[model samples]
Target: MSDFSGIWIPLITPFADGAVDHAALRALVRRYADAGVAGLVALGTTGEPATLDAAEQDAVLATILDAAQADANAADAADATDAQRRPLPVLVGVSGNHTASMLARIEQLNSLPIAGVLIAAPYYTRPAQAGIVAHFSALADASAHPVVLYDIPQRTGVRLELDTLLTLAAHPRIQAIKDCAGSLDTTLALIRDGRLQVLAGNDLEVFSTVCAGGSGAIAASAHWRPERFVALYRALTEGKLDEGRRIFHALVPQIQLAFAEPNPAPMKALLAATGWVRNELRLPMTRASAALTERLAALGETLPR
Candidate 1:
């Protein structure tokens, strides 16, 4: 498995003319590859995975793997006189309510070249912590790839309590977590517990998470200012607290606005302003406020995207 460390972009699925924009999607992958993110996440919450059909999801993952491979190959050719750069691994998000189907999904994904799977606790059902434990353990047991547990209680409506998390950590296949449970004590406890590699799923906490001895982040705000995010992670990992704080402080405003409205819309708006992708999204998911869109465009001028 690829190291679940450093910055990763939960890529937005770019849409255009009412269809998946493969050209723009590939461009986005190459953009992040050049920026040197640790990896790319596909079909994540930020990617609007809920709105895409199975076929669309499959295509998106394939495009990301292909682009990452091509980008790595090109970099090697360019620097053939030196050691080769490893292609960024792709992490695919898998979510479902039914355990059997979830396990089946993991089984299907085992055939792919992905590095791991990012899965949130079962949503809407509000299962007990024991049920949550069983759900994750069952998936982990069935999965051939590593599992990164996502604990965003707001969306899933039930916290994967710290005790439950500690228990799940014992599974060899459950290697890490996307820590969105919204508790500093929980975050710190998980870090100190020294079991699972805890990644900040909340964009605002990326720097704090890394500084607190957690792994890195699977950040949505990273869709913009990606290089700065990478720099911040590097700064923290190397114990340059002042440099890390400086980068985090500078990025706070963008992080706040990126999530001010619903996700990805504001993120996609900023990307569209930069001519990276169309500002379109699927039904039930709309674009950002025209007011915010203007601001994002202005903000885009300041970022290195």
Candidate 2:
């Protein structure tokens, strides 16, 4: 029932000494909220949710929800003076390789104060399109909150096809999609139909997708250049395409470095360089190279407000 039709940042997990840095994590969430993000997605790919254990996931979600509620209360108090102050919605990502495990995870998350769930298409198992539809349909019915489909074929190894996506859209509990299929044709098909709100999961495709009548993005790079991404979305909404393109071009380099290495490694390094979070990651995902870190730092310096 939530209208997820704007920019949401898939927040990165902050680490210090191979542990979840709760203080730093809270600060980062506050920063995203203050930066005017439409929503915050905790424990997504960028959050390195896969690296976290069950306890850590629960703790992180609690911290994020607590801070979000506080912020919402603050915004309500400040409504008389600053219309800009509003609490951003919190979205938790629940993705796994097994359908049953994912269902269990969704059940566990039902108690959280999250606005909705972002469920990635089952990875590695590569279930058929029909299986994918059935799995999501069951999840939508089970979830207490709305469900946002995550279709990043490059990472998940299985694409949620157009027909199946259309079918899934009709389900009342299914709200929107984090579309990372990286295909203009597929994006256009969804937009032309005007059924589901299409969020560009890939940063580079955001401008085109918005121009093509899609909703907005859930950008990884938005963690760093939050204002620029916000301005792009606002410009598009205001029908100022030329201004939006200028901001988009200015951000191309930063977006490139955000993914220059594998995901949160590069993003974490960038955040660390800016003193936002400590430059650390759990095992199996090490810090970025010295050169990449330096480049990200330089790119961070060039970003506009």
Candidate 3:
């Protein structure tokens, strides 16, 4: 199975001048690479995949892969100690309600050098458990890369029940899961099963997940103070519980605030403060409110330099 452990950032697509900002996008990828993130998930929910058209989405992904390659080369030259310098593994997020369309999309991504894909349950339609099983099974069978199932019910409106998840875990192609089901029972059960790698989809759950014998996280809050996030992962992985808990405690407040304004808004606002990219989101998605921004700045002081 493909390893989906450690801290993975679901990058927010940087926009400027009413188009995808490839420059800022590449720089952001390089920054994460330097911080030694386990990998990155391109076009994930945080990346605003729904708002981007096919061409724009393709361009955004190309930029990230390109940056990963460049960062790998620099790391080799500098003899960097961390794995961040290596060609970072990249995961593409692919989801849809249409089975045929979703299968085609997975097939299309088979050619990329991605480690695997992060897929979600069919949304809105709320298909039966058997239908859901058939849906993901077919997609995983068609995909060349490993599959990481996403179980985020709040956004998808349907949950992949524990039985369904265990069944899917038996599939060779279906490897890991992004656990946003908000059910600690499911989280701990899946971890106990020890089949699929369980990655916490929520930022606030990263530390607890790691300490709970599950894998790391696919976090959006780590976009700002990424290295500290990495350190926490290391501390937990190395069994430094006290150290890990301390870092996690300090980061709890900011992590909560980042999602206070509907993801990627407050996150982008904080990133913009770093001058990495403008705090802009596409239509239907606005920037974090002025009040939220001010509150965020005050909380951001707790982040590591």
Candidate 4:
């Protein structure tokens, strides 16, 4: 199974003049790469994939991959002996409610060099447990890349039962889980079982999840202060509990404000204020409010430099 641990950032797709801002997106990828993030997830929910058409999605992903490669080469040139200078693994988020369509998407991804695919339960349909299992199993079977299950019931309107998860864990292709089910019992259970790598999908739960023997997180909030997130992950994994706790406490405010509104809005706002990307989101997903942006800016200033 691929090592899907540490603080991975689900990048927000930057926009300018109502188009995908490839330049800004590449810069954002380089920023996170330099911050020592474990990996990157392109076209995830945080990236506003829903708002982008197929061509735009493909372009955005290509830009991210290209930028990451460039960043890796630059780092290797600067420090050939540094093991961490190697290219960061990149994962593509593929989701859908249709089985056949989703299969085709997964098949297309099979040829890519991504670390894995992050898939969620079929939304809206809320299929039965058996159906859900079959859905993921077939998708995994079709996918050449490893699968990372996303278990967020709030958005999917269906919970992946513990038994269902255990069953999926048995599959060779299904290797890890992005746990956002909001059930501590299930989270701990998966951690205890130790079959699949459990990555905390919730930003706030990153601390608890790592402390409880789970792997790391795929936090959207880490987009702002990724180094601190990486530091916190290292602290926890290295038995520096006190240091990890302190960093998490300091980060709680920023994390809360990042998600104070729908994801990527406040994130985009802060990034915009800092001149990283334009503060624009496609219609139906507006920019973060002035008030929230102000709060986020203030909170961002408080983070360590």
Q: TM-scores of all models?
A: 0.97, 0.95, 0.97, 0.97
Question: Which order, best to worst by lDDT?
Answer: 3, 4, 1, 2
**Compared with the true structure, what per-residue lDDT tens digits does model 2 show for residues 1-305?**
67787789988878788788989988877777777778889889988887899999988888888776667667656342231255568889998877778789889888866789999888888999999999999888889999989999998899999999999989988888898998788889988887788999999998998888889999998988687798899999889989998989988888888899999899888888788889988878888999999898887687543
> What local lDDT does model 2 show for residue 247?
89
- Candidate 2's displacement at residue 45, Å, is 0.6
Query: What alpha-carbon RMSD in Å does predicted model 2 have with respect to the real structure?
Result: 1.7
Clash total of candidate 4: 0
Q: Which pairs, if any, clash in model 1?
A: none
Where does model 1 exceed 4 Å of error?
80-84
Model 3 agreement with the true structure over 120-214: per-residue lDDT tens digits: 99999999999999999999999999999999989888999999999999999999999998899999999999999999997888887999998
Query: Each model's C-alpha lDDT?
Result: 0.89, 0.85, 0.90, 0.90
Q: Give candidate 4's whole-model lDDT.
A: 0.90
lDDT of 3 at 132: 93
The per-prediction tally of clashing pairs is 0, 0, 0, 0
